[model samples]
Target chain A: MKAVTYQGKKKVEVKEVGDAKLIKRDDMLVRVTSTAICGSDLHIYHGLIPGMYDDYVIGHEPMGIVEETGPDVTRVKKGDRVIIPFNVACGECFFCTNQMESQCDNANDAKDTGGYFGYSETYGGYMGGQAELLRVPFGNFVPFKVPEDAEVEDEKILFLSDILPTAYWGVDNAGVKPGDTVIILGCGPVGLLTQ
Target chain B: MDYRLEHAKRTNHVETYNFEKTHDIDQTLLEATKGGADVVIDCVGLDAKRTAMEKVETALMLQGGSLGAFNTAANVVRKFGTIQVIGVYGLKYNMFPFGHLFERNVQVKMGQAPVIHYMPELFRQIQTGKIDPTDIITHRLHISDAPRAYEIFDNKDESCIKVVLKP
Candidate 1:
């Protein structure tokens, strides 16, 4: 299978990589139909974010058809179209139950942060979604089922993997109220989305 | 340039600023908002305001870049106003405006945005016409052009606000 891999700082290339398959009982294999380059990925690209290893596949946003699912994965089936969240969260964890999947204790035990695919060793080193296929851990908890009848474009919904929700989280975190003036400094995707 | 400053003006009624043009952002915003802005959010982080040499030093890992935007926020936030820092900052800073922020009784909230937590509501909003996240995508390239795409976005080239790579 073909996937994008990190060559070095300021370098990324399309390369042949092994195919993805179900690794854990809660895992699901996704045939990626759509993916986006996230701002967080750029951080990894620049080598600014630590713990990144060479040849690590890099991406976070992905939505596609579920090719296979582990027996423990109850929320999504093999043929279902789903959007995979960047964080690989076990629904049973303390943080996951508390609506904090990004900080789920079960995914990345080395740090307080949860498992984010393709970030590096610090982020649990899961292979990313910018590939022919992806291995999604704890699939039942993270894969959001897209409606069969809905007709939204992949470009429109691909952001659900990270940025859109992140922007919404920013506004929500700031406790933005009606008639309140909120100032955003950076005009990057996340900042623009927040605006 | 797929700029959306007009949207801010129309919906949020926000006024834009070019910090380079205005020598004193705090003074300008202070006067414009009548004393100060009620809420000041710092999305610009470590590299917010740095001299050319200062940037070089930070790049060489000499001095830590921190609180450039926070200082501006501390100055422009009204008495008892709130300042939300969305920008990532350093663990240590040579100088911090603790006195000003403390005296103003300003409320501050800062942290990583819990992306998954907000996904459901935002997804619903996008399903409706309430929000459009795709509008920010200024460039789209093939997966083979991923390297160039990363360069353009990192450099902010050609007014590139965002890039969505088609893989």
Candidate 2:
């Protein structure tokens, strides 16, 4: 399979990598149809993210079709088009129970600091979706079904994997009122989304 | 309104503070607001050139009125006006004119934006045509050209607001 790998600072390459498959009962294999490069990925590209290793698959935002799923995965099935959340979390953890699945205790325990796919060392070192296929863990918790009549494009839906949620979070965090004037610092994707 | 100059231009009420050719930030702001602005939001986040912590210290050293975002916010705002700081600064810092805040009764708000909580609402806004996130995407390139996209975005190339790479 081919995947975009981060080599070092300001470096990335599309290279051949081993195939991915279902690794857990709750895991699902997705044949990636669309993927996006996120600003967070630039942190790795610029080597600002410490502990970044070589051959790291680089991407998190993706919308794809389920190629296969483990027996325990029930939220989506083969042939279902879906959007993959950036994070891979166990639904049974305290954070997951509270709807803060991004900080799931069980998933965090598995990695140094758990995060979604394609993040650097600070987050969990899960491979990302800028590849031919992706192995999505806890598929039931992360894969969202695409609306039947939705006219949203893959690029737009792909943003739901991280930036869209992040931008929305920023506006909410700022407590922006209906008529309040909000000024975002960075005009990057996340910042622009706030506008 | 550094990177937001273009977007702010779309809004009739938005006044920009360009530091590139102007040294009189206070005066520039005053002219923009026509005496003073009701609210001042700092998006520069401790950027040395824009934040100018040293300049603020110099003003304090000379016993000058408040300067920089904090002091400017205090001075240029109407009494009891609001100052929302979206910029990042040193946690263990000092040298701010804390007394003026009380004198003017200014309100200061600052913090990191928690982006997850607002996803549902933002999504609805996009769906409803209230805002177009795509407008910010000034550059679109192939996934193979991702390196160039970063170069343009980082360097702030002309009219390059956001770069989207198709993979």
Candidate 3:
């Protein structure tokens, strides 16, 4: 499969890498239809993120038709349309149950934080979804099924994978009220959305 | 920057400021909010524009990326106000305003967004048309065009805000 691979500072290439397959019992393979380049991906592109080597697959926001699912994956099926959230969570961990999936215990071993798709080894060594195919682990929880009946364009909901929820969480976490004056610092995607 | 500021003003109907143009940004924000803003969200994280000293420090690994946005957040937030950081900040910084925050009873909340926890509600909002996120997408290219996509996005070419790739 062809994937966006990180070469070094300000360099990337779409190379033919090995196909992503179902490895874990809870894993699923997704035939990516849509993917996005995140602002944080720039950190990797600029060589600021450690534990990244050449040709590391580098995308996190992706959604598509599920090509296959492991036997244990009962939440989604082969033909289901789904969006893979950037966080790679087991869904059964203490953090996942407590609404802290980003800090899931089972995702990343390199750091104390949770696992992230396509991020450097600091988050987890999981391959990114920039490729034609993505191997998504923790399939029971990681993949959010796009409502089959919605009939909305992918652009409308693709940000659920990251920035939309991120902006919402920023506002929600800060307890911004109806009359409260909220000042967002940046005009980036997340900042714009937060405003 | 003008394009984004204009977009924010026109679409969201919110006041926007360019830090580079404003001589005293914190003072301006404080006056605009009539004391200080109740909430200051830091969407620009470590990679924000740095001062000459910060540029040198960051180059030497003596500090994290620029604390410019964080400093502005600190300065523009009212006493006992909240500052939420949605942007990514890694490593340690030299001048982390602990004393000021502690004295003012300010609250700081940060870290990665646990996206799964909020996905359902956001999805519902999108489905209901309460918000439309598609306007942020300025480019749509094939997955094979990723190299050029990265260049344009990194360089902020053609007013590129977001880029989506179709595989």
For all candidates listed, what's the TM-score of chain B alone? 0.86, 0.70, 0.96
Off by over 4 Å in 3: none
Clash counts for all predictions:
0, 8, 0
RMSD of 2: 6.3
Write down the DockQ of candidate 2. 0.23
| Tens-place lDDT digits, model 2, residues B1-167 | 36566575564234444556569766766666666655655544433243455656534443222234455555666566666665444333355768877787877766533323334555566677765556565776766675676677656676676565555
**Which residue runs does candidate 1 get wrong by more than 4 Å?**
B1-13, B47-49, B52-57, B60-66, B90-92
Q: Tell me how far the alpha carbon of residue A175 in candidate 3 is from the true structure, in angstroms, after superposition.
A: 0.9
Q: What is the TM-score of chain B in candidate 2?
A: 0.70
Q: What are the lDDT scores of the predictions, listed in order?
A: 0.76, 0.64, 0.92
- 1 or 3, greater by DockQ: 3
Candidate 3 lDDT by residue in tens digits, B115-162: 997988889999999999999899999999999999999888999989
Task: Name the docking class for model 1.
Answer: medium
Q: Candidate 3 chain A: minimum summed lDDT over ten consecutive residues — where? A: A146-155
Best by DockQ: 3
Report the Cα lDDT for residue A35, model 3.
95
Q: How does each model score on TM-score?
A: 0.90, 0.72, 0.98
Rate residue A36 of model 3 by lDDT: 95
